[model samples]
Target: MQTEYDVIIVGGGLAGLTLAGLLGHQGLECVVIEAGEKIDRVDSVPDDPRALAITHASRNILASFHAWQCLPQDRLACFRGMQVWDENGSGAIAFDSTELGRPTLGYIVEQAVLQTSLEQAVRSLSGISVLHNSRPCDIQWQDDHVSVILDKGENISAHLLVAADGVQSACRAMAGINYRVHDYRQRAVVCVTRTALPHGEIARQRFLTDGPLAFLPMYPDHQCGIVWSTRPAHAEALLKMTEREFNQALQAAFEHTLGEVKESERRSCFPLRRAEAEYYCRERFALIGDAAHSVHPLAGQGANLGLLDAASLAQLILEAGVKGRDIGGRRVLRSYERWRKGENRIVMMTMEGFKYVFENQSSPVPMLRNRALNFANSFIPLKHTIMRYAMGLSGDLPVAAK
Candidate 1:
């Protein structure tokens, strides 16, 4: 293996792999260092309860990296419409693909399935190498290049270092970058359920007193991935309940939107928090994905945002290379930072605002928010604009995302 490359990516997760594949396709030598073992393709369909909402822009970005082609067609669940309502009031908003003259709103894909397909796509690129079960123990940023010292005593050097490690990113810490975090004091309970009635290819979200509850349609007509964000105590209680008891609680929470919750798979829970790096890039080192920023799952947009970050950063790097400019120079790296930071901040703040409004169950706040929802729904042009933004069609997207 080459000890020197054009770029060295820290973290072989979805974002890192996507970046590597894109750069490799552009003929840049890239290496990805992952802490986990290489994951094989999942033979079972829709086995993972954790699902991701792939926006229209995200699909375009994946197709650019050729990862979308690697995904199993049977495992993808495309939702044509969405419905969001408030449980405390009769205010709601609905969106359909036809409103924008599109084929579908977005896709709901299992997390494991997407990652495995991306891995396969990255590995297929001749200029890219994935070093699984290897982690960077030390990093030295020089004037012209960055050196990564791995735990296995291997030394790797690159013109640029990209950190796509998750929220608890070691690279971010090693780079001595500060990040601001806001804890929601809640937990998101996730699982898959088989409802008595079909989902009708529509994603549903109900804003309860605590947080948001989303039922994302999956591959099967009667199965859906449920994300219930609530208080920590409530999430714990839901997890401890038996299958039948949990089903009843879920059904009650959703008000039998899809009839009864007949049965559900195993349950899982994770704390909710949003974090953003103080700086996205400096010198030869740059941050992407959760390492740069992370948001609440209210919109299931964390993954989509990360993918956009990769595409944006990759586009800038490629552009600089074509111009014979130093791809890792501060000028080049800062361009990527400037383009993504504002876009990501807008999304993070939007999710935070939504969470705050939905959680404030007080009398006037709820009434005001409900009215706002209804008013927005009644405004046709505004509703279509919001839908387009949510679908990622009306943004200053990178070429890959476009």
Candidate 2:
């Protein structure tokens, strides 16, 4: 859209759009390069099958930037409690928001709603531009600026370049960053389900031998967005079943915690993997969102982590700008990196640990984890700590999130 900008974000997904809006709001000229069509409020995109558990801190960040209002209020579901258990063990744990003197724990937001709304928010900003279907090629890093060659041969320059692309990020490869990847060897099968009983605004997860199965409350009280993670083979087999047969299997899987599953959509499945870059920043480039790190979906913290990354970087960049410092300088970029990497690493490691403990069937491990879960349930302070962590209310929150 322009030959130059203060910041050029390489993806227009949630992270990229949020950063663009925040930075643009702060008076920085920002541009987002996306490979897809220009999506905004006018786009007739249907509701996405996937929903994210947006922590309270993330909601604060969104509210700070005014993007929260762009989302449809009717489409949001707030969970006041959570129930988790091991299907093969006696360990069961429950958490309630009331313990923390809060009305709700967090919210399950439809992915498409937030993404489109964020894109629209960026578009509304005078200082931010969105270039859709204009793919960037021939990425080159310079000491003072990052140069991007468009497929049509138009060149653009920016003081900072951020890769907010998804897990399989082309920009990450272009920057020559190394990442550690672990395939959980599980596939997540997602679909909308309607049960005989209501979800009661409680998000539930059952640790199966294959993986964890989560039924997140949707906007409708009787329906849920189910993430059924299991081995790839099992996912495929489940996908092949008829709707009735599928509901039976689904009910059997969750042990009908919400009662008989009466209806379900055609299941969609994707492999689960945890990935993290060795370094988040290099020269004039930085990675955020799934491009920087992607964790197992068992915890639903992956997107929340990425959004925090965007907020942290945005705050740092704005602070640097006010000081007349080079936004892409190694020192500046490293500050953003240093601020985010440790917290992200902890989240990734925590997810991996959960994946390991829940996905394994080793007799002793289940009993131990179950005992721990039961013990945790019995301890009010421990449950509060876990709830705080899950709600993104713990740890070092960025300025925007705070």
Candidate 3:
């Protein structure tokens, strides 16, 4: 017998789970099918090597769903300032949250902690159901609904099907949406390191000819999260180096900003790629998070973008349902696509432009880039606009927020 639901969400990651919670809160019946066997407790003390720089808009959305407060206070670290410098020059630009009258520019949150919080929120909603250890083997879209075949040979049907899977999205592929992909020929090496001095709630980034090296301030002061984007060969070498050698290399690259780096946790690497689907939705299917688009992590906007996608998509669905419209209709889903696609494309283009400008080795380019940075730093109005955009407050938003 096939189980039926109003919505069936594939991939129980952050985006899927958060959407499930939001829809359930609105009294919608939804079921989440997760391929993973289980969700476990996230290490509370920032032991995870990866963290996300969550924006204010994302926080607001999560708070509305009553999910943000579930995170442990100790696990969250607020950054009031950010400094960006040219790797070849002494020129730099800095942004302070006080300049914009905001208490924090953003928060650096552990990936596991964020995921666990969303999972807990999902579990508490009575209208949402979770199925683990299952993957969608097939999807069949009908005139009024869609059917999903699980790996266990069980069929499930729903009025709407949501795909929150990552960049290599099986759901998007199954939906037959046109997508464009670009391989950056770069890899991001992420790890945790104990600094000699406290970070003092400041996040830093250095733009080098190879790529960008970002230091995200984490809780407990002396520990920081490192996302070093470099060429694949260089990243591989760095990953295999001994602890002392790795620390030395890291310290040199960062110009000893945090003093001597002593130790590093597990190091991992992921290829940098950009993917944007032609549309975010079809008749009875929708795509959210990485499944829809993925930008470079230079600005640390990947996860935040995914969260925004979730919030906006949820709002659109709920409002349509409230109006007694066909929630899965192409017309309803088109609104989501039209709203989110353009915004995502702009960010992707901006990141690509930044990557190209900073990664060029021409001596003349550095001076020009540094001048631009200094100008941006000295200009109050321009800086404020940039800050607002970075805070996720200035982007094109869904009608729910309005």
Task: Give lDDT: candidate 3, residue 154.
Answer: 90
Candidate 3 per-residue lDDT over residues 163-236, each given as its tens digit: 99878889999989877889999999999899999999999999877999999999899989999999999999
- Among the numbered candidates, top lDDT falls to 1
Please tell me which predicted candidate would have the highest TM-score against the true structure: 1
lDDT of 1 by residue, 246-300 (tens): 9999999999999999999999898999999999988899999989998999888
Candidates ranked by TM-score, best first? 1, 2, 3
User: How should the candidates be ordered by lDDT, best one leading?
Assistant: 1, 2, 3
Off by over 4 Å in 1: 44-48
Q: Runs in model 3 with CA error above 4 Å?
A: 44-48, 399-402
Better by TM-score, candidate 2 or 1: 1
Candidate 1: count of backbone clashes, pairs at least 3 residues apart or interchain: 0
Model 1: worst 10 consecutive residues (lDDT sum): 40-49
Query: Per-residue CA lDDT of candidate 2, range 1-402, in tens?
Result: 469999989888888888898898888898898988866463465546887889998899888878888888887889999999888878899888998999999999878777888777778889988988877787988878999998888899999899998888888998999978988788999988999999999999998888889999988899899999988999999999999999999899898788999999867888888889989999999999999998888889988998899999998888888898888898888998998999998888888788778777877887788888888999888888889999999988898987
lDDT scores of the candidates, listed in order: 0.91, 0.88, 0.87
Which scores better on TM-score, 2 or 3?
A: 2
